[model samples]
Target: MPGPPTIFVARQPIFDRRAAVHGYELLFRGSAENRFTGGDVESASAINIEQSTAAFGLDALVGERLAFVNLSRGALLQEFYRMLPSERTVIELLESVHGDAEVLEACRELKRRGYRLALDDFTDAPHSQPLLAYADIVKVDLRQTPEALTPGFTSRLRGKRLSLVAEKVETPQEHRRAMAAGYDLFQGYYFCQPEMIETRDLAPSQLSQMRFLAEVSRSEVSFEQLEELFRRDVAMTLRLLRYLNSAAFGWRHEIRSVGHALMLMGVRPLRKWAMMMGFLRLAGDKPHELAITALTRARFAEQLGPPAGLEHHDSELFLTGILSTAEAMLGRSLRDVLTALAVPDMVRTALLDGGSRLGAVLRIVMAYERGDWPTVESVRTECAVDERALTDAYVSSLQWAETSAAA
Candidate 1:
């Protein structure tokens, strides 16, 4: 028999009106073709449904929130969704699934069994009525629906005891429009894009963190220098001591001073933790997912370095990944954000121009995050990395980020 098929999976956050993650839409493709072809969708969906409900489990993808799984007509009729938990799974029907009698009855049965149904890329087509009547959620594709018609289109879907989700919202303006249009949930990269308004100067604490990051980014920074930086910032000092004493570190003795903590963690490990803390500090009051994404990308890129022939520059690769979202957190352009801090030439080039090998690694990490498998495949080949290695790195990074963020 053939070995188990490769499953490429990525998740996009679904946010509530308050910008909190409500769930995630799991995006997956059976192969690198990037689009559903032949029996790929059905076969992949079946394997995922089984794995998500058992074995690996949904906790690997989403801790405890709902999982929105796409279902083609064949999967719906064949009851592949039955393998998933009704209360925690949202069966999202593809647009190609018509409201024929068979599908309508299948959706009705799903509702009676307590599974919430969602209509994907909804545009009020003639064949939508049968399935629409049973849907608990309707996703409006903002890219296709147009801003001028958003409110009117969403208004008709409201007050029917169903939530309206704004899909493909890519900017702050689109996010605001979706909110004004009464979309209860949002899905896209709006939160990851910088708000295009008057950029505020970095706060004193933020500035201090950036300076600390700059100092630590160097491979030769003295521990005393790092400790002095921590000593100047009372909050950083307290955070460092507290982190070392925290249960995650399992220290039998309390770590009372910044110097002792820095020495104990050593140079390389200290650099990693300190940089991550700095990123979290820069994240400030943004949604928690931003920090998580930064951590995930950082780890993912760091792991890719060895495979991509940049083994000696893992630290810079990690820096490149973490700073990838600086613009989103700082509310400034990427160039402005990078200018405020010091980074190596490779990192700067990767962030600014994507013209280096480090840039290629960053691109692969990003494409993998968005489930843009075609780009991922091309970039992976361009970087000369094994596909399985990339998949393992991403999966491990996701788990690591969750634990790291929680700690």
Candidate 2:
């Protein structure tokens, strides 16, 4: 069967004074591979937001936590903000939104309907003051606003009964400054940076599992080839048999040998299973999210393969996704990890440089994950996949990851 279409959504956490997660600002990219054109921003934002909410549902995107969604001036005027639950939804108006009569009326209506409003990238300009009357929160871009101006900015708004949100808080010092400046909330990458850890040599078992994964990823494999590798580790042998006989598979007869399991589970399923198992075994003390990310990327790439004219080489695409994060997950450079795993030149080129079709798709996946909607749109146009296909693939990948993590 063909894989799912690609759709991408990313959430940036918002923190309160105590440094606890208060809510998330959900960012949407319409297509997994496409960039937004210089067309109507309101229409594009609305389309992407609607597509994402339809695919994942609002609860799946933000869980029980509150969610902040950006509303273009057009969306606000049209009352699209009313679609979401008011108690947990914060309707964010862009700074570019003019405080015209229509917009101000929309803001008043939204507040009257019990929807909290935020002004994104707030600047204390004369144009923004009119909207401030309805804004419950104001986000100041620390990167763009000078430190000297921040105190006066907050001081001026002190009587407005609005919460101050310090956006683009990129450092510990900036976080402290924002707090001192009377900001009530914070948002940025200061707290999400990965800790650098010393790289270590792989254990014998891990090395074996790596080799086993490499073998599974190959184009052709025989029962003897799989059985020989399975016999080297008793645990792997049991895992294979158990998976094949599990209720999910529902085979008519019980499997008795590794060969039987291999025959029952086709090459594609076997390869995915082996790859997932290998990653689980190798991810020692690593964050569980890394595994989830790798698996999701793998499924996403595989789903994109056929549409990109790589129908016969989906396994390679899957491996490309899985190995893309090896550096971060293993605390080693990608070049070194790929060299050790003996990945093909095509996969290597895709990872090192965006030179091939697979490389283009991989780039799209990475950009989408980071919420880089423009890059995603450009890459999607370059790769020639439609928005619906890409969005479906991404949503399917998320569903797959959720199921795999639970399993």
Candidate 3:
């Protein structure tokens, strides 16, 4: 009745291809007092804008690392985009929006202001003609359509412009079908699956960032010195604060700089966060969904912590587990990925081979997600954490994330 309290980004088999996750759609469900909106379309229309938009923004800002949400054409017409951060998100025009002059013009204006636009479930329609001019990405629903018809339809629309994005892609086969059909972007569950390809190069900026963070985290630098290190990288500095001030940080006041962040975040948490920051740096958003999923996994692993003393090994465990989907993230080999980044050999073994204590901890984290209580229990016994303790940790962490954190 309440729908899900939240829509979780389903993390699955990391597929063997390259795709950037621009943003995700947030489909809504009504409050207890309100009538339900049937179908993702009419349901999208049934809302009171001021209430739901604010709620969605507040919820997303608090819970996620920047995500893109869908706004109904009516919502879009109302200029809901004005209220949210334009760069960090994309305004999706639901398939239900008619391709017409007013809508198209409004879309152009949003684009002019630096907002990204996504066209959903496109087919060869006269209405879509105008919309595609300004649409940055096209989301094709694979749940209802097969691949055979994609090429002609997409070719007619794409014609040297716009990337065709295959959405609702749920399996490895679906991924293959979409890729073969020339879909420039992909979304779905294939990220969890093992693929034959090796790793690829991350953007130069991303590489430089991870290298910098790795050096900073490992340096004999003081908190004061750490401030200078972050200052050297403006984007990284902003992200660290955003992540810190986010509901994720569990802090008490406004944090102004890297040194302040270090003092509040502490050495262990700082190291864990620095590695996470490193991962984000290494994987600067090219394969967007994979990046988001990896971010989730890293956050999950960080919250779960590592087994005591393989000696400062938990941070490495967090790094490895976050990268478990490396193959799917970049459609390449795990070994190749490590080599490209020059990741240490120890991390290479734990992440790719899935050997060692770190690997075992990762196994438990995955098992916990699958609701495999017994396997979780086995790992818990091995790690010296009891079931109750693990449950408590999860609850406390969620509360901390939801309430005390400020970045």
On TM-score, the leading prediction is: 2
What TM-score, computed on C-alpha atoms, does each candidate reach? 0.45, 0.46, 0.39
Work out candidate 2's RMSD over C-alphas: 17.8
Which sections of candidate 1 miss by over 4 Å? 1-6, 31-39, 147-149, 192-407
Model 1, residue 23: distance off in Å is: 0.3
Regarding TM-score, does 1 or 3 come out ahead?
A: 1
Where model 2 places Cα greater than 4 Å from the true spot, the runs are 31-39, 147-149, 193-407
Across residues 197-277, which tens digit of lDDT does each residue of candidate 2 receive?
111111224545655654555445567867876777665665455444433234559677787777877765555444334
User: Deviation in angstroms for 156 in model 2?
Assistant: 1.5
lDDT of 1 by residue, 1-407 (tens): 65333445556789998889898786654455434455545445554554343323465567678889988775676465754567788989988889999899888888997899999998767898778789999988888776423566776788677899888888888888788878899987775421111111112266566556545644356677677777776756654554455332345686656778888756544544443445534654443477578778988998999989999997788788878977877678999878766578899999999988999999999999999999999999999999999989999998877555433
For residue 21, model 1's alpha carbon misses the true position, in angstroms, by 0.4
Q: What range of 10 consecutive residues in model 2 has the weakest lDDT sum?
A: 194-203
CA lDDT of each prediction against the hidden true structure? 0.71, 0.70, 0.54
Superposition TM-score, candidate 2 onto the true structure: 0.46
Compare candidates 1 and 2 on lDDT and give the better one.
Answer: 1
User: Candidate 2, overall lDDT?
Assistant: 0.70
